[model samples]
Each structure stands twice: as C-alpha cells, then as structure tokens.
Target: MTEQGDTHVKRKMPKGVRKGGTRFPRQTLGDSLAWAKKLVAKTHLGPQPEGVVLSGVVGNSNSVGRVRLSTLKQFGLMEGDSKGYIASDLAKRIEAAPTEERSALYRAAVLAPPVFKALFDTFHGDEVTHAKLKQRAAELKVHPEETGKCADVYVTSMVTAGLATLDGDKIAHLSAIDMGTPPPSPLITEQGDTDEPKVADDDGEGPEDETQPEAPNPKRAIFNVNVTLDSSLDTEKLERQLRLLKKFGAI
Candidate 1:
C-alpha cells in the first residue's frame, strides 16, 4: 500500500503518447470557429476530399494541418474521417448566425469538448490560475510539456464562449455559465399554480426551499472535515465534489 499523498501509479507512463493527459484543442474555440467559417464558405458545407479540405483550411494535410482538423473535431465544429470532411450542423448554425447572436452557439461548442466541460466544472467557483490548469491537465495524463499550451487554449476558448472572464494569471471568473439550457420555469406558474397539493399548510413551502436548500436536512447525520493537500492535489475539484455530494443529499 502507498503512504498518504503518494501519487505513484502502478504502471509506467504509456508509450506513444500523442499529447497531454487530458485531451485539449490545438487552437482556441474562437480560432476553430473562424476557420470553420472560412472552410465552409469555400466548400459550402459539402463533403470534400482530403486534399480539398486541407487546402480549404490549412492548405496541407501535414502536422499543423492535421492538428487544426483535430482541434475542430474536438470542438464539435467539423466532422470527417480519412475519406472526407465537412462542417457539422452546429458549425453551420454558427456560420449562419449573426456575430452578436452567436454567444450561445459558442457556449455550446465550448462544452462540446469533454476536457473543456470537465475543466469548467472543476474550477467554476474557484479562482483559476494558469499553473492550476496546467497541473490539472498533466494529472489527466497529458504530456508534461503540452500542458502549458493546453492551458492557454482552454482559457482562450472559455473566454470566447462566455463561460469565463480572464484577467492576467487569473484565468476565469465564471461570469456566465450557460450549460445550453434555459432557466427552469418557476415551479409555481406565473399565476402561482402548482401541480402537487401541499403536504402541509406550513412553510417548507418557505423561501428556504424555494430554489435549493442551502443547509443539510436535520434528519441527516453530519460530520466536519479538515484536509491538508499538497501542490499535487487539484484543490479546486474539492469544492466541485462537495457540491455534488450536497446536491445529491449524500452529506
């Protein structure tokens, strides 16, 4: 058994690792969108041969070109295999949208990448840092050297998607979090109507239960916790996990 804070894995790092632990895009979501727009304009969103697709975008199927294609695929903006390529429906929607009306579209693309969603969920309420992001990326099995660029792309994408507000080393402030859903309609309608009859004429029924309960139910057992973590720990995830625990009534 390993000692406390021991992070050693049982096996060596995998061979032929192509990129960082967590998969990250080669370019920002903004850049992906811009490129997708241009490519679709040239191809008119139809399926195209590899050579045509490459020429339309990066002008070659070389390493840089392949990375750009992979990045767009990661963002769910383009779709193709070795045989052919085309812009996705979501990409077409964004292309059709006016510049000012594309915020929600961009947010949808931002969350399309699994890494983007996972990172956002982890650091949503915390003060995010570049070092924190890079560390977290490395922990996810990304190549150590690639984590820095991964962090840069993630931050820029989040900013473009309206999911984050970046300021210097502080990456995201979570200014706007739209998980591609409209606000839940009020449980009681605008006319103050409800489907279920009240179990009591009382007030749980009060403002405390209105949105979501802030405190644990009295019937649930509770214990206090104190933790000590090293720099290797992704401390921001602690908050996200705690919220999940409370949200699921496991507190």
Candidate 2:
C-alpha cells in the first residue's frame, strides 16, 4: 500500500507550464458548422453560392471578407465546387432561425444606456452628430473609436431587423415619425377702415367760424439837401473829388 501511494504522488509542474494551465481549444468543424447553419437561417439566403450571397448580406465586407468566406468553408455547411463555394443541402434543414436572443455582450454593444443616449442624441439626419458622440465618449472615458463601433453594430442589427436602413456609407436612415396632415390656412386679424382728417380739423379750427382782419399800407419818405463851398475851390479838382466820391458811394 505504501509503495503504491508513493508511485501515485504527483510532481509540481514547471512555472511556465503551470502558468499556461489547460487552455480551451478552438471550436471544431462541427461547432463551426452549427454556427454557419445559424447564420444562413438568420439571413435567409437560399441555395446560392456562399461568396455571392455573403457579399450582399454583410456590410463593410472589406474588413471581414476573408474571415467570413474561410469560416463558412471550414465548416461542412458549404462546399467549394468548380463554380464557387455553394451552401450545402444542410442549409435547407434549418427552419427560419429564431431571432437571436440578446446576450449581455450584444446588449452592451447595442442597447446599453450610453449607446441608446448616443444614438438618440447623435441621430440628427442620415449622418451622426459626431461632435455630440465625441463629447459623450470623452466624458465616459470610453474610446471614441469603440463608441463609433458600438453605434455601427447597433445600426447594422437594426437594419437587418428592418427597423432602419443604410442610405450610404456611414449614413443610416431611420423610420420616419408618423405625423397627421397639416391644417389648411393660418389665422389672421382683419384690418379696420381708415379716414383722412380735413385741413380745418387738423388745425383745430371750425369751418363755419370766421373773423375779419384789416391790411395796412405805409407811406414812403423823400429828403432834399443844399451844400455851400468856398469860392477858392478848384473846379476840376472838385469835379474829380465828386466823381471819386460817387464811385466810392460817399456822394
């Protein structure tokens, strides 16, 4: 008994190996097959080639193109023939898959309070109000890029559910609000008639009241003068002086 116990004793693992521990392996082909089946069922692309079908369904394919195509092929859900990778017969076995339940991860990405606020506040028209989103993300200490990614995911999911649409790149058009028809004409006040005042009324005088006033003329005055000079006065000089005085208005 003692010898068997000693033989069964376990040794301490090396630090590196201990640190690594038992890591979960990547999903197998069967797991990926199940995932592919779910994707096809959700998207409802019939028996077409996977590549062409996926190209139409997914958004911003440049980012996820290779991974998406390879993943579908890695599983048994699709087979690559002479034409291209075509969805397998197993795709038809899946009924329209139920709408995916929102996990905590999906909720955090889409329906979180902050995300809802950002969507409500930033959605002015087709384009997001980037300034408002940036400010909100800064206050929350969340990276602006991550906030934008969350917004994009929410928009994409909503669009897939037919709640919204992508008008163009980075632009989403939401369902319109239902407002009733407008009234015919606006209300206005009518203007009363206006009359001009007579000249006498404006001057504070009655038309019938009159008083006589007299006009006066004044008489014009005439003056005569005589001048005496010495006999020794020079006639030419006097005449010249008189002419000069008349010119200067002294006469």
Candidate 3:
C-alpha cells in the first residue's frame, strides 16, 4: 500500500522536481535562464520579495520554487536571496541579445558557478562521465553523497546550454571556450595593431551569419582539413586566415 501511494505521489509533481537534491540548481542552466527572463519581465527588472520572485519564476512559492530561485542564483542569472531577488546584468543582456548572440551568452551563464566553471575548464573538449564528475567533486571537496547529483546537474546543464553535444546515449563533445571565452576576444596582430576577423565556430558560421552547411557532423571526428594560403605574403586576409586556423588548433 505504501509503495502504491509513493508512486501516486511522484506523479503529482513536475518532472525533475523533488524535495531533496544537491546544493546546486536542480533545473538546467537553460531552463533557469528562461525562467529568470520571465521573472525579470514580471518584476520589471527590479528587486522583489522571495515569494514574488518565486511565484513569477516558478509559478508557485513552494519548496520547488525555492529550488528554482536558487538555481537562478547559482547560474548567476538572478541576484539577491530568499529575502529579495533580482536578475543579474548578464541575464538582462541575454534577455536582449538576438538568437545567435544568445548562444555565447548562454555559455557564459553556464560557466558562472565556480564548480561548473572549474569542471568545464578541466574537462571540456573531452568525454564527460558521471564518475569523472564524482571524482572531480572529491578533488573539489564536495560532499561524497552529493557527487552523484552534482554529475547529473552538470551533464544536463551543459547539454541544455549547448556547451556539450551528444551522440546517442553519450555526450560526444564538451565545447571549448578560452579561459573566459565568448564575446570574441580582441584579434590582435603580432605587431601593435588589431584586426577583428569573422570567426567561425564548430558549425562554420561566422559574424556574417552565413547559411549553415547541410548536416554538418557535430562529432569531433579525427579528420584532416586542407588549407591553401596564397604565396603572396601581402594578402590582407592572410593574417586573419592564419589566426583563425590557430584558433581551431589546426596550426
């Protein structure tokens, strides 16, 4: 009778919403961001009471709502605490940025948490696993029992934030950002001059907003790419081309 009752209770709550979990956000960075935006809109980008923020952000000022609010704070999307809460500047920018620009903004938000940032810095562009997260958590000094929940949050958050791509049941690639990548670093020449080039990402889309290639594989397959530079050393774009190749680690 207790087992049947427990099953019925589980059906009453939202998916992924529970009474207990890790110290970090139970919601993915992406979901938290989306909800944060809504809260900002509801509150007119100003501070509001905990209940007000929670009601705006999560639909009800319940325990789950409190967790959602905490998730926003953890992702650096929302500010203040249970007493009062407000959206962060980053959240505002994300609110205003267009679709393409939001991609980079999302990445920035995902790396806001110290643990999440550390995880990305240490393990990005490599295969990520729950065991790896738990191991790293030990290194980070997180509670042993919290390791499993931590891993679950990180994996789901990265995928939702587009920082990691998946292949079937496994994540294939964890996107690489500079120590603090995004917003495109200043493209400085060897000399004391600067030239900003249209940088292409893994998808080969640049600032010009080029049409995406049909079915470009997201898998980081080991394949060789050819680059043919002109013999003339005076080509203005040569520096840009070389710099771009270097960014892709092709040099």
Q: What is the per-residue lDDT of model 3 for residues 1-251, given as tens digits with 9 covering 90 to 100? A: 46654664433656445434335556788688779778768767468888877666778676777777778888888888777787788888989889878877887888787877777767776776667778886677666766777767788888877777655445544545443444323565546454644444575544454575555567865567798989877777889889999988788
- Identify the runs in model 3 with alpha carbons over 4 angstroms from their true place: 1-23, 175-251
Stretches of candidate 2 off by over 4 Å are 1-114, 121-126, 129-136, 139-141, 173-251
Order the candidates by lDDT, highest first.
1, 3, 2
State the lDDT of candidate 2 residue by residue for 1-251, as single tens digits.
47655677567743212122111112233334345555565445444454554564332245354444444453234555424455554433432334453222222222223434345334524454444444555455555334554344445544443334565454453423311223223334334233443354356444553663332334633444344555687999788767876775555
Q: Give the TM-score (vs. native) of candidate 2.
A: 0.23
Report the poorest 10 consecutive residues by lDDT, candidate 1: 175-184
Q: Which of the two, 1 or 2, has more TM-score?
A: 1
Tens digits of per-residue lDDT, candidate 1, 76-152, equal 88888858888888888998999898988898898887777777767775687899998887776767878888788
Alpha-carbon runs more than 4 Å astray in model 1:
1-17, 175-251
lDDT of each model, Cα atoms only? 0.75, 0.42, 0.72
